[model samples]
Target: MAREKKYREAVNWKKELRLFPGYLILLIWISFTFVLLGWVLLASFSTTKEIFSNKLLASGLHFENYVKAWINSDVAGIFRNSLVYSIIACSLLIVICAPAAYVLSRFIFPGNKLIQTGFVSAMGVPVVMIVLPLFGIVANLGILNHVLSNGMLLIFLYIGINIPYTTIFLMTFFGNLSRAFEEAAAIDGCPPTKTFWLIMLPMAQPGIITVTIFNFINIWNEYFISLIFANSDQLRPIAVGLYSMINSMKYTGDWAGMFAAVVIVFLPTFILYIFLSEKIIAGVTGGGVKG
Candidate 1:
């Protein structure tokens, strides 16, 4: 027994040794990411000259950098715009996708598979291919800069673009849900739609929150479509506004302020991941666990 235990210990050691290289690579990657983020945080408080001179933190923490980035650089308005876009887009996405996904997962209708295939295939199509035609449609509709109308248009664009991904994500979650709940609801005289709304959706909360966080982050940082549709400074989201700031950095030379803006733009997603990462993991794994 002692000899057999020794042999098994040796075998486990060899398996760990085999994985050492992968472990080393992951450690290096994580170290690099931390170092990069640390540098950005340090730079956000340092002066541009100090940053360029490799003297990070020499300026002794300049809070004014954030002020300049937020007010002088006009990031506050852009941040608000991004907030509006993300909120409306995510809300509309759930309203539209949840039911559609539940139906697709639960019901058998004509062309259902075709619709599913179309949504999956749409995910692969490049945005550049559709942007130009979409631009033309928006232009011909004569609703370019009408503030509220344009805002709604941008929200619609966000919903339209993200619908495929959200639908597919929710479809998997709904498909994994047990039909026992639905049968129970039916026995209680609940209608199909009510059963879905009251029963399935509550059970799918993890997936919905996971997908909402994803869509919020995506729409908040989205640039290309927003750039094409919302070119005006007042309508620009953080992504587009940041690009403009970078362009003007040549004249402004406020690298510290730029880094501050970057941090501000990145904070929401970072905090979200820090808090809800477990929910995200649960959502992705919950479907697979049952199957």
Candidate 2:
């Protein structure tokens, strides 16, 4: 009995030792992250005077900064623009990418492998390399200087850029699915379109959700492309809008307001991640598992 107890204790010690590094790393990461976020939160409530005086760390919390940001700053308009762009771009991406991915996954055709390889290769090409050509095309189309025109152009650009990756990801996901189900549908006299829509689509939900979430986040957070394309304040997404706000600080000196704007910019994506994290995880895991 004593020897058995000693063996159990040895196993417990080994387990504890194994966990120690992970615990330490987690603790360190959490501590640093909390400190950084806490600093930003505190800064949002602090006045310029408090910041310059180095008294921001000691100042009492001021909740009114958020109200000022929402009411007086360009943040409200920026938020609206971002929401609109993200919704449109994400919806269009999913609609286009889903059907395309579904076709690519199930169909066998001449040049299919070549097309797939082309897409995968395109993924490695930097956006900057194509930006000038894209700009020239939009300019030739007479849309570069207009806000709504440029916004729509950017949406199309995002769709094109993201499609390759989304297609490949969904192809891999759909490829792993069993042929038995599709075969059964065909034997039941179901048409190809009907089989895809009613059977394969339902099964591919996880992959669809995963791709949509990724695209939504990427488009929402995108700054450089929006900046290059969008020429007006009204068209600027939150990312570029926030940068403009900070740049305007030289003249306005609205540090507190900028911080509040930052918080507002961060809120939507944060809320989305919190809510959709479970769905994203499930989608990725389901796609990874083979039948």
lDDT of 2 by residue, 1-291 (tens): 999999999999999899999999999999998888776778888887786776884678777788888777768888888888778877787677777777887889988888888888887887889899888888898996777788788778777778787777788778878999989999999998889878887897777778778777878888878888887778888899888787886578878777878888888878888899887667556543211
**lDDT for position 182 in model 2:** 86
Lowest lDDT sum, 10 consecutive residues, model 1, at 282-291
Q: Which ten residues in a row have the lowest lDDT in candidate 2?
A: 282-291
Model 2 misplaced stretches (Cα beyond 4 Å): 1-14, 17-22, 51-61, 278-291
Show the colliding residue pairs in model 2.
none
The models' CA-based lDDT, in order, is 0.87, 0.80
Highest lDDT, which number? Answer: 1
lDDT by residue (tens digit), candidate 1, 1-291: 999999999999999999999999999999999999989999999999899999998859998999998998888998899998899899889999999999999999999999999888888888998999888988888768587777788899999999988998889989989999999989999999888888899998878888898789889878889888984678888899888887897588888998999898898888888998887667556532210
Show model 1 residue runs off by greater than 4 Å.
1-20, 281-291
